[model samples]
Target: MKKTILLLSVLFLLISCGKAKNKAILQGKVENEQIAIVSKIPGKIVQLLVKEGDFVKKGDTLAILDIPEVDAKKSQAEGAVISAKAQYSMAVKGATENQLKQLEAKKMGLKEQYEFAKKSINRLSNMLKDSLVSQQTFDETFAKYQGAQAQYNAVLAEIDEARKGARIEQQTMALGQQDRAYGALQEVETANKERYVIAPQDMSIETITLNLGELALPGYTLFNGYISNSTYFRFTIPESQLSSLKKGQEISVGIPNSDKKIKGKITIIKQLGAYGNIATAYPDYELQESLFELRISPLDLDEAKDLITKTTVTLSL
Candidate 1:
């Protein structure tokens, strides 16, 4: 009879303590946001500036890539720009001195031929008047004179064109070519800059996925880091207790096995499905029970700075 009474007393005390603790505290985990550093351009890793466990700040150089393909493309674009500029200059300046001189010489030669043909036609007409030359012969000579005049006129037009520079349409086309080459060069340079991987924010390098001389493909993650600002506490509570919580409301959190209590703000509250897995201090919480989730951020960053991630914590509302 004495043994039975002692067992009953112990069982009741254990149940009472569990109920008291569950009503006052909620369970949560400490977590930080993970960041993956990826490259936009694929290339061999030329240099690794940070190793695992290193702390880095925003815009810090993380690594460098050796991209021979980008260099080759940049070179081609530069050459194209030079060629386009020369073409544009030629269009704007019209013909060169040597070209103009050659056209003028051709015009002079055509003029001499035209004069000779005119004299022949006159002589043929006179012969025909005396009936010494056939009418067919005079007709043929007149045709020759006309051909020479037309050729001389054409030569004069060409000389004028050489003196005047290229046409407006030609100049516009050359300018477009130059613009295209410049745009291409700019694109290559931008991509080349991307090869120098840099940290986007303050973080701790958790992992280095690629080593020196390894190929890093485009969009592939090269490093994994933890963002300090993303640290937060997540708690699972019974839905019956959710009415007491609201976003942006301040609350006190109790750290297990430590006297250092952290001040936090209620940042989120959401209901979970009956089947969702969650971490909570309440041992009676079951899959069939209705539960709510709460996310809180530390109001005092310094106090929670040393907290290890993914560790269980207790929350007081």
Candidate 2:
């Protein structure tokens, strides 16, 4: 009976000590900075690189879209661009001098024909004056001269037209068309890259929300999720503790259910309250105020994972 009494007394003392420990009833949850993986453009999902709870690092591809259509369009545009370039080259380097010589020869022939028709018409006019050529012959000769003059004008216009538009200018226009086509093709290619979601940050991919073969598009349901490389729990201390919490102040972050721990610095300490009131003005102004937010960064973040988001433990208050 005496031994039983001693055991009961010890249990009561242990329970009393446990009740005396300080614990704040804080309503906080565990979560990393969840980054919503997004697609850059619209396309049908062709390949899913991960599933739910799959871990990934930065630059990891989450999924790829069916890009065959885009590829075909790009190819078509590319071919057109090539053809345009060839046309531009041809326009810049015009027809050879030999071809110009042929045109000049034709011009000379027309000139000779025009001169002969004019001389014939003049002779007919003189003949009519002498009553040697008939009126019908004079009229026909005049008409022939007019027709020859009109033909000469047409030929001269052709030569001028050839000189008006330069071969280089034509080539430049064709090159511009090619550049536009090439830009369009590049845009399509860029869209294709965006369809395959990649890790936007250097952190790990915490989850894959959608399954493989699922249709994913921009602004649609995302299939992948990410978080920061390092994670930390937050603590708010009274304004009185601001002086104590300086930059680079050593902090011990406790890990629950494991022997692991992270040593970090007191990276941030609010010098003023939410209303921008200084700490010295607090007691003179009001008693009802919220604690300032403090930022702490882990010195060794090798395993400072999102899993340790909520690390609630006894901190000097």
Score every model by TM-score. 0.84, 0.64
Would you list the C-alpha lDDT of every candidate in the order shown?
0.87, 0.64
How would you encode candidate 2's per-residue C-alpha lDDT over 169-212 as one tens digit per residue? 66678779878878887887776677677766655555555565
lDDT per residue for candidate 1 within 230-317, as digits (tens), equals: 8888888876677788999998888889887888999988887654557675544545668777888999788888888889898764
Error of 1 at 163 (Å): 3.2
Candidate 1 ranges beyond 4 A from true positions = 1-6, 132-144, 273-284
Task: Report the poorest 10 consecutive residues by lDDT, candidate 1.
Answer: 275-284
